[model samples]
Target: MLVSTFHRCFVAVCILLLSACSTGYHGSFVERSFYQGDITGLNLLGPAQAEHCQSYALYLFPLKHSPSTQLAIKQAKRSQPNTVMLADISISDTTHWKIGYAKKCINVTADAYGKPPSTSNG
Candidate 1:
């Protein structure tokens, strides 16, 4: 009985850790926060006016899908996300079976654009 209890606790802890790693960003980012150098020469396929476009991989808990969107916005390294456009989350239900619990993972692709950071003349 003691071993079973310990096993359950271990599984719970593992799940918590995995969930934490997936939520890397929060709120928004400032113009200076992005590595502008990276976006400039990224060779974006389509011609964009002010913002750069990029794709980000997201794994969300279907139920709490909002946070994933925020994370994706940050991934684009955009100071202002004019719109958070995301492709349909893959329609797959397969998950890793662990202790009879299925862990969900789905890819969320996105495209974003915004005004570049301002250069202050301080």
Candidate 2:
């Protein structure tokens, strides 16, 4: 009886742990990247690329918010930091209901391009 009870408790604990195991999602495709921090605006030269991030709370409600321009740009910079970000910023987010998640997020997007050759130190 004790062994059975222990097994049940262990299973319950594992289930709870798995439910909220993952938080935050990020994905990017970059030819090259480096952090340029905050900038006033982007001077696009090359073709533009965009990166957006969706930050969540309980993972169920799509929490729409602001100030993600810097965050989004930073993420984009991570993809190709040596590039550019045009000043058109958009913000939005969505929620995905999975078996174990009630996901929410805030999305930020901006146009980007490779930096000029003259801007490179190395």
Candidate 3:
């Protein structure tokens, strides 16, 4: 019984460690920018060339529009950091972007998916 329990514990520890390492932000520079009330224009950087800024902008749209429910805003306000480190993994090239006031920070990232539809195609 003791041996079995030890094995379980070891497995749990390994799983936890792997998860912890896998989960977290992987971005270059995270900055805070002014929100001009338009959530669509926020620029985000990532791996892909064209979609990086657009991806981040899309991610931040909800946060700018609905600041009340956003956890990042709350955390930023509570932490009172000029810039908070973000661990978002959905962004392309592992790059992330942010924009907001000192009290709030909106998270944005580059899209990891295929290139955004070209304008000419539309």
Best by TM-score: 2
lDDT of each: 0.38, 0.50, 0.35
Best by lDDT: 2
Residues 1-122 of candidate 1: C-alpha lDDT, one tens digit per residue:
99999999999998998677545533232232233343443322222112212222333333333234334334433322433322222121123444533344332333333333458999
Q: Report the lDDT of model 2 for residue 56.
A: 47
What's the lDDT for candidate 3? 0.35
lDDT by residue for model 2 (54-83), tens? 444455334455235456556644454456
Per-residue error (Å), model 3, residue 48: 5.9
Question: Which of the two candidates, 1 or 3, achieves a greater lDDT against the reference?
Answer: 1
Off by over 4 Å in 1: 27-122
Instruction: After the best TM-score superposition of candidate 3, give how far the Cα of residue 105 lies from its true spot, in angstroms.
Output: 23
For model 3, how does the per-residue alpha-carbon lDDT over 33-100 read when each residue is reduced to its tens digit?
23435434323332222121123243323323322223433343333222222223222223233453
TM-score of 3: 0.27
Ranking by TM-score: 2, 1, 3
